[model samples]
Target chain A: MNLALVTSRDTDQAVRVASPLAVRGMTVSYGQTPAIFSVDMTVRAGAMTAVVGPNGAGKSTLLKAALGVIAPLAGSVTVFGQPMAAMRDRIAYVPQRTSVDWDFPVRVIDVVMMGMYRKLGLLGRVRGQHKALAQDCLDRVGMADFAHRQIGQLSGGQQQRVFLARALAQEADIYVLDEPFAGVDAATEKAIIAVLQGLRDAGKTVLAVHHDLATVPDYFDDVVLLNTQVVAAGPVAEAFTEANLQAAYGGRLTTARVDPESVAG
Target chain B: MGAEFVALSLPPILIGVLVAVACALPGNFLLLRGQALIGDAISHVVLPGIVVAFLLTGLVATGPMLLGAAGAAVIAVVAIEAVRRLGKIEAGAAMGVIFTAMFAGGVLLLEQSDTSSVHLDVEHALYGNLESLIWLDATGWGSLLDPVALAGLPVELPRMALALLVIAVFVGLFWRPLALSTFDEGFARGLGIRTAPLGLALVIMSAIAAVAAFDAVGSIIVIAMFICPPAAARMMTNRLGHQVAWSVVFAVLAAVSGYVLAGYGPLWIGAQASVSAAGMIATVSGIILGLAAVAGPHRTRNG
Candidate 1:
């Protein structure tokens, strides 16, 4: 099943003909200043890949670019060996919690129903079947009880779970999440990580823009260290090393101390 | 005198209902999108456009004047977009600046033009005449496809027919996109809905509604028809579809009531009065808005 087109000097460097998710030479700019520069990455099917980087490291930009939310100044992104536009329905995006106005007057059920909007189109009213599916997704995220409650009424962790339910309702093969764990409690974090693991176990590829480095070893099988460009990417054991962390952090590590609780987690 | 009153006032009242229905259709979309002020701005700013069209054509025709007003409203939208994109101005702020400047320019143009003899005064533009509407065509319904006729009903079918067509078109063409975009523009964009085109179409429709009201009620009063009914309906319901329905019902009621009241109000008060049909309808709509504001359900929590 491993179709390697070319064998390089390093056996690990062979270029495969197909990848579930592939981004090559991606560059993104905000107005005049470039935020991400020529980044290359890939996520194999049925794997959980975590993207870790410092602030302003363009972690969120990379996910947004992959989802076609932000146009890349350079390079291309593909899903299931097809362009993003062609496979849009097959990709689910969980934007950062802060990106949306939580105070918007919509119930959790309504927010979850938004996931079906792509298939439903503008006029396709959410009927019984769609509501059932939304309920199922919410139940899977343990938010079924709060289905009727407005999203703004929920706690921070509960709000994150609601967003998870939204993405879950999409039923997409690939998932892209930006800081799903930020500001969430331990129990909620564990629940979300379990959901991500369940997705990978179900033979789906998941790419998460993560901040907590401590959970990386336990939660993800693959890692991509980004500092504007991909510093390293591969299996977690080999790719996430102290030297690679230093390369990603550089001199910023000298002045800053990594929280023991964060590293120990 | 009673029959004379009905003869002179009925056509304008019917026309006002049509104008309110048209404006309300687009007004729901604008209010939902948090762009409610746009209608008010367009009504004020289109004054110069109407005057210029009259000056160039040397005729006070409704068609050319509406076309000119629509063109100016489109320009204002473009200017707002440009200001937002280039200068990083807030959308509301940009709209405020563009409309105020355009309106001031229109007032200046009105002062400079020899339009007094032609009845192109700013007051006439602000408050239009329903008195002369009898001279306008209110016939030709028998030639239409509908052959079922009420022989002796004193109804102006031509005007009613035109109003129905405008309402049907507004609801048919823009129902879905308007609802989706109004709720969340980003989500609408994600679903491949072209918000800019939808927004432009809505603005154009608003200008048309304003023009229609301008002839029957006047430009200043058109603001009430567009804003008050929708605002009142919004306070009563959170659902966009329901709000739209309520707005139409409210507008039609206000139009009929205002027309009837304006007709008998003078005799009842024992005073000689010539209250504009449009102004009375606008006043009624404003009163409804105030009542809605006072009686609306209060939400202690956000959402």
Candidate 2:
């Protein structure tokens, strides 16, 4: 039985690739307070998965630990069946809009070009082809005209779109975004969702720390309900039930009512 | 200006210009990262580094000074981080406590050591003896180009230039990574660009620039040059490339004009001796920053 189990594990590694992101027993802390505890999850390939949780729910911390931005207290994350460090360029991150000072001296084009840094590496010359790609990404986000404009010139929604455009320029196989929908306009919300869906349809993994439960059923194929830990994780139909939402939201989300039939259909 | 006057003042002006350029490039990044205080902190902290190096080597030269400066820079960063992490103090408070302590330690070391026998002086460390640093044996312009004559030139000038060149190469080679990491550290880390090393590069560069130019410009003037030109450039331009270019231009202008005014302005007012050129250079940089803050393109456009 032991030999059979070992053979099965070997087959799992050799015959099939690991999911884009697999988190096991992950824990993170801020100072003395624990933010996330033993959170286990897997971001399946070629799907849009929303990580839903309340405020201070360790949503951002989970992503930060996974990317090795903040050192995790415990556990590990594997990307594309390898360590994150081994497969880094294949994943891109979009930090929250508020994390950066918009008034920093950089144009829209400059911000987008930053996403190309992974490909350019250190000291690589930014060629005409790179500029063309940045322009194309800007156009995709309806920010082509504002390429020359400074980041401060763009409004909040426009800023979020600009960020999305930069992520597009990265062309990573997996995208991780933090609070992309916060304080965004309706049109920007639609644009962001469309871009995410486009990424999903192109066989890319997109995991976002999303809050708007109203649009969860419409937007995501899978969901990871989190509340300092993984409450439930799987397809939208089986996992994103009212029970999981309640558990993740800790009964604070009084109005959450997901119809299982529609999710299944 | 008279030929004698021009020849006498040229070295100090060149020295000031090089110092400003070196400080401004690193300053731009520091300002962007909101770590402007780090430049201020580094200048003060480098003094003790210089003293400790002097004590260790019993000789003062480019090599020992650079070593001391780099050591002090590392100590300051580590101390600040340690205090912030272990003691749970905020970064600013930690910086304030450590830099002042380091500066005091250097002063104490200088007082305790047999530094009197050396050419290095406390007064020179505070306000550089710009007039005394001239290449005393030079004949004329021809002397400058002559390789043998160039060798006789004061050790400070070449050291400053080499330091500026080092700063240029450091900034030029790592411009993209530095910008990305500074602007969005989390995103940069996600892209697999280790932000820690990039941050370490900035600290080391600041220390090098501070130590290299400190002998000529003094630590206070180093502080001024590190902040003023970049702050002015930032006010003027909304683009990072333009900000860096404009900072260089502003540095050169402040250096040249400040020296000219310091030496010749006394004559304009019918006085005899000129004021300290290093002081004037720093003052001019400040004036330029103030003007930019009020009338810069960013302000008017935003308005």
Candidate 3:
């Protein structure tokens, strides 16, 4: 399947039509409680997009629904113009650290290798090639030295890096990461953002569920402001306004100067 | 005198060894999943099931009794899962309620039935009887090749062969899913692995293992057989594949040694050997578990 070129609603209409990821009218619920409501958004290829919202704003739920980890209560999610299941190998997901057991008895290399499990298939052993790819992913994340260490032994930021390494190993066209910066050290956070920026520069779409409002304008070129539903989404300069922030965070967004260093140069 | 001892002691030892192999295989998976106490619960709750099957059939048929036991165990598992899902109770508490109630019902059933007169006793269920396993019949290639050797050896290979077959089938069929699910449920699910069939298969396998041991060592000692070897092996290894391999080796060793002890140890002590082959095998497994606890890495202080 080919990646669909979606119309950019904010930039000049004549700029060019190219969007790699799109979720149309996606709704998700936990039992009777609706977590997300009819959310429509599109992500451009070769662009880093940040999904920013307050807690309980359905940010994590949206990412999970896109990954097909949780079936949407209503609507559909498409990656590169194909359904989620048909494009399982093309999309990589990095769940939040809190979603997994830190004490699981597996090494960092083992965690990274899981990204290759789907490609390997059942009864398909991990050959030398797979191991080499996994190591390369680790090296890219600057975690090659810690590859053999148990995941539980790593700090929170290190754990997040290991997860990113796993996603890198998948070699997918798109990435959906949930809370990639929560509780990580400053260096680890910068390293993660650098890897993400690298992915964006290499013609890949990166969708991150970000919590720190302070870094939105700097880290992401595009922003989707959400509170149960899509309040706004477009170029960072256009969508990230004080009025939209107030709508999403409900007076929690204090007006402050955006950090210059946080943005991609 | 020595010939008689060999004839009487060898079969029980062989049976104990088989029981150890059976329990050790599934015990590793169960322990890794942190559902170790389910073994205890299944053993206790299956008592009523066996008693009821016996009452209906009027004969201690291994097939029907095992089926009944397995059915009861499945019910217990489903009940545990349901309670955990619906009432939000801990798995251990749910298991406790189910097993105690079922075991009490079994005792009541046994006391009220005429099967009690036939020595279908509960004490025998707890301790087991190695002396009762006499040579029933020797058939197969021995009869075809050499009638004399078959008559001379008097080996009961059928039962042991059957037990080994069960172990092989389960390990072969569910090895991958079992390993994955034991380690991480979310990761397994993310990979699109269907866990329900594997979980059901494990419960059934545990029941089959328990039933296989019930004939040789009785129900209560089956717990030791199922739990001890794997626990001991865990102390020695952390890798899932290595743990299973070592557990099998430990189980076979326990069986043979327990049999030998039951047969020969009594001669030296000059006292009635209170410990049956099954009990000895379990005790050996327990000792192995203790050593593993002491020497193995990842030793939990709480344990």
Fnat values, one per model, are 0.16, 0.80, 0.07
DockQ of 2: 0.67
Q: What is the TM-score of chain B alone in each candidate?
A: 0.85, 0.91, 0.86
Which residue pairs come into collision in candidate 1? none
Q: TM-scores across all candidates? A: 0.83, 0.93, 0.83
* Candidate topping TM-score: 2
Tell me how far the alpha carbon of residue B177 in candidate 2 is from the true structure, in angstroms, after superposition.
Answer: 0.5
Q: Which stretches of candidate 3 lie above 4 Å from their native place?
A: A1-32, A37-43, A252-265, B1-6, B136-169, B172-174, B262-270, B300-303
Instruction: Give the per-residue lDDT digits (tens) of candidate 3, residues B136-226.
Output: 3433333324656445542323555586688768776667666666665554555566666677678677777776566557765578767
Name the candidate that leads on DockQ: 2
Q: Which stretches of candidate 1 lie over 4 Å from their true place?
A: A1-17, A102-105, A125-127, A246-265, B1-6, B130-178, B258-271, B298-303
Assess the local accuracy of residue B18 in candidate 3 as a C-alpha lDDT between 0 and 100: 71
TM-score of 1: 0.83
Query: Which digits, one per residue and each the tens of the lDDT, describe model 2 over residues B1-303?
Result: 444543576777788888889999999998888777777788788888888889898888868887887788889988977887888876678888999999888888988889988877666776776666776556676666778867767788988899889989999989988998888888888888778878878877887888788777787678887889998998888988899999999999998998888878888999999988888888899999999989888754431
Docking class of 2: medium
lDDT at residue A76 of model 2 (Cα atoms): 82
Interface RMSD of each: 3.5, 1.9, 3.8
Kindly provide the TM-score of model 3 when superposed on the true structure, using C-alpha atoms. Answer: 0.83
